[model samples]
Target: MIKCIAIDDEFLALEIIENYVSKCPFLELAGTFSSPLEALPLLNECGCDLLLLDINMPEVNGMDFLSAIPNPPLVVLTTAYPQFALAGFEAGVVDYLVKPFSFERFLKAIQKAQSRLAPRPAGGTGYLFVRSAHRMIRVDLDDILMLEGKKDYVAVHTQTQVIDTLTTLTAFQDKLPVKDFVRVHRSFIVALNKINTIERNVIYMGDKKVPVGEMFREDLLRRIG
Candidate 1:
């Protein structure tokens, strides 16, 4: 369920939104506030996936409130004024619900927020980040030749360079997609796509040769088949 909070200066507007939220199975109303100022502390403490906000609230309007947050939650603006529709979208709102909106309209807004929060498409560009030394480094899975485990640390061997990361081979294995990479030995993992030759029990990536463990041989052959 998407955890959400509602904020409106009008008590009746808050009640209507709370009721609408209750009806949606995909939504969970974490809290409701008549004053946006009073809701700030609760919002920070409870956390939320989405914010149902009214634009014309006293003290601080919804647009200004959302702008103040560095990384605000997905917003669905609720107000009688259609004039602020363009402004709301500029502030990164998922959807704008003109007040006195139907339950169906509210549901559509929630669905829009859900789409934004959804995970990226699978096989995501075949790249990921790993921490090396004191910094995070981007490593392209397609460019990786092999991975070698040195106890608590693992070295990622790419086409042009070797990156020593502060993570184990097992941990790296779990992160890589099974279709493009495989764990062939206890201390070694190889990129199946980058394998140039397999001689006896050894796999070769350019000049680098990695021994394939006996236990992983059958699975490797099956995958390659």
Candidate 2:
């Protein structure tokens, strides 16, 4: 079972999340807090596997709170603001849920997070079975060049072809091994070995140019060398 905590200043919001957590057989709700500050100590002590965070809080915002935590648990941002979605993904949040979301939507998000945190076999050939339009396609890790985000969906660009899926870039990032794939932008994640050249703010993979975000530049440079 996934140990989880919910943080939101709104009492009703917290209640809703509590109800959702109670229903999920695989989830164990460790605690709930109105203050992000109070939640920090509990998180540090217990080391929760998942966090349901609110973007808008009193003293410290959700984004700032997440930044302060070192190696935070897989976060699912529960907020009314949709604009923070991209920034949340950039901050390594597993999923973003706009307030007043249906139970089905919440389940989908949690399932995605569970899949992300699930353990894999050691030192084996890492492959992902993705369902395309009509058939399930098995994709080898070595063939993937980069993953591009287009709104809610992601396009996995491989050496042979580009496969589109109704999934978030953050979700894909969680599944890919960090040593092999690195997220260089809110919209892009590239295979480390496939990098041909780095010039200014862009990365060259043969002829294609992928722009690197300012925030991710430092990590990308360190990886390149």
Candidate 3:
């Protein structure tokens, strides 16, 4: 079961989420909090695997609160404002639920969280399976040299070959371990250890060169340096 906590300043909102959590067989409602501040102590004490958080709260809003926590659990942001969706994803939230959302929509979000937390092959293996042409292909994380996004698909550049899959670059970025990979541009996510050299605003990964955007340059330099 996925242990979870619901935090919403609105009492009715929390009640709806709590009821929804009870209906899901795979979910266990650990606690419900109407106050974001009070929820902090309970979060550490109870220990949860998922968090149902409200993005707009008094004093400490959900987005900032999630950011402050180190290695936060899978989160689903609940907000009336749609503008916060992008920021929520950037903060690593698994999904976003606009207020007054249906149970069906809520269930779909939880399903995504389940897939994300699903157990991989045991034994310290650093690899993930990506779907391609109705078949699942195992790609070793260490073999990845860089990732290039092309519209709807992303090309995973490995040392020997490129694996093209029908997935967004942001999706791959979220799954990749942050300590080993960094997004250097809107269309490029590069492996820190596989970088051959950085000249100007370009990253050379073997024979391929990926351009680095100005916004992501500082972080990329800090990670490599």
Which numbered prediction scores highest in lDDT against the true structure? 2
Ranking by lDDT: 2, 3, 1
How accurate locally, in lDDT, is each candidate?
Answer: 0.79, 0.87, 0.82
Q: Per-residue lDDT of 97-172 in model 3, one digit per residue for the tens? A: 9989999999988887786676645686488898887989899988888888998899888888788899988688
Alpha-carbon TM-score of each model against the true structure: 0.54, 0.73, 0.70
Estimate the TM-score for candidate 3.
0.70
Cα lDDT over the full model 1: 0.79
Off by over 4 Å in 1: 121-225
Which ten-residue region of model 1 has the weakest summed lDDT? 86-95
Clashing residue pair totals per candidate (backbone < 3 A):
0, 0, 0
Q: Candidate 2 on 140-211: residue-level lDDT in tens? A: 988899999998789999998999988878778878866688889989999999999999999999888999
- Superior by lDDT: candidate 1 or candidate 2: 2
Query: Which of candidates 1 and 2 is the stronger one according to TM-score?
Result: 2
Candidate 1, residues 108-177: lDDT per residue as tens digits? 7777777656654576755779898888888877788889989679989998889998886745665666
Model 1 TM-score, all chains together: 0.54
In candidate 2, stretches whose alpha carbon ends up further than 4 angstroms from where it belongs are 121-124, 129-137, 148-181, 191-212, 217-225
Clashing pairs in 2: none
Alpha carbon deviation, residue 122, candidate 1 (Å):
4.5
